[model samples]
Target: MVSRGCCPAKIGELTLWWKGPLWLHKEDADWPKKKNIYCQADEALLEARTVSHVLSTVKYDLSIVEKYSSLLKLLRVIALCRRFMHNASKKERLSGALQAGEIDKAESSIIRLVQASSFTSEIQDLCKSSQVSPKSVLLRLRPFLDKNNLIRVSGRLGNASTLNESQQHPIILPAKGVFTKLIFIYWHDNLMHGGQQAVLSAVRQKYWPLNGRNIARHVVHRCVKCFKYRPAVVKPIMGDLPEARVRPAQAFKKTGVDFAGPFIIKSSLRRNALLNKAYACLFFALLLKQGT
Candidate 1:
């Protein structure tokens, strides 16, 4: 029941000044004489409420390289991660080392990171006393860890003296991983948009991707350059109807229209005349016409 031009009223510790129509001033005080009892509730009369948390578990996505959409961009991120770790270990916020100098190491480190994420169970088994489980996909490849803890294919060529280490024991990669697909694309583009078999063979020289054939096929098929240069499929033209099997029809009822090319035409009869091009539209009855 406040009105304009009314006397000042005390509302708890606040006082509304009446010098103007609407003005409020809080009075300075050590303490309020009366406490607000409406806000206080009795502990015994209060209802008990239980709080429950709904925790949602999310499965980790393996295709992290797909997020960046390019292998080079992902490699730069890995290089940055390496720089961060290097700085952390040294306990300094300053620039530790040149990123370009360690980019090669970062490349290998990124490959290892992808391998770990894709094959957690295999890595764990290899790290522990037990070997990779019998049900593991890597069992068929005879996978063994290298000094850098990367899984590599163990083939009979390991005994060969002339072959290099990569050829003898190529790195193992999961076929479905984005990083592995990017590697396939890299090799495909690097080889001038090579065929599927060629790309697969080139990739196997350094890394043995599981289901490599399918992945290579997919990568080759998805290449824009390869698709652009790929020759158009020539459909076999239908054979013309034989005279004995020809159906009798009205002359203009079964008419077919076709287009003829731009023939060079003389604009004038003079020897040094300008040339022009002309096209012809041909219309013919289907029964009498032969397939071109």
Candidate 2:
């Protein structure tokens, strides 16, 4: 009999044997990988559908005039004429009453002068028509009268029935010059220099001058008491550094010293051992470098 281990191994030899040839076939080469394509045709179609819907729903009126154009024009003209007639009649009635003994002579004269100045082409014509002098208040208010056309004589002055009450006696004034100054002083003093709003209120109670708030602010701004007592913000000025800190010096030349601690230290490892005190001190010095 052959020895069991005699032909056990051989170099580069397969120890296990196959009964049949191995089945092997190369897989068909993978088709070239296709790139993913993203299409926006659906999104474009959706946007076009939305735009078409909006265009179909929107309505625009392009006609110049509707069916009732003539009727509307007639109604508008009637309304305008009615307003003009009412204003004209009211002005005539006021002028007659003003020229009569109903209102105070001084007040009436001022109102008539304002009305005349409002309608006149030139200041000289206003002066001649109203018999007002060049130094009159109305003369000074020529520009204001031209701009506002506020000569409504029918309404009571300061809405007051009578002119005796000082609070209800209205007076027209030019924005500048002696009359404005005097008015401002009278109201400001009466209100005890009580700030801009207070003075404005007092003036408005009796006066209807143009640019009255501006005058009040001007007077208040110049008030010595207001200036002296008004609250103000103050800024603190920074002080200069000390000569030692600012001047160049060597390290430790001018140093600051500090004490840190006095810690307790045990003399021995035993719990009954005596304890000792320890201390630490620190010193800081300034340094200067080219970059710093």
How well does each candidate superpose onto the true structure, as a TM-score? Answer: 0.57, 0.29
The deviation in Å at residue 64 for candidate 1 is 5.0
Clash pairs, candidate 2, are none
Best candidate, TM-score-wise?
1
Q: How does candidate 1 score on lDDT?
A: 0.75
- The TM-score measured for candidate 2 stands at 0.29
- At residue 213, what lDDT does model 2 achieve? 85
Error of 2 at 130 (Å): 12
lDDT of each: 0.75, 0.49
lDDT of 1 by residue, 126-162 (tens): 8884468899999878788888888998899977999
Q: Candidate 1, TM-score vs. the true structure? A: 0.57
lDDT of 2 by residue, 209-237 (tens): 66878888888898778778886879899
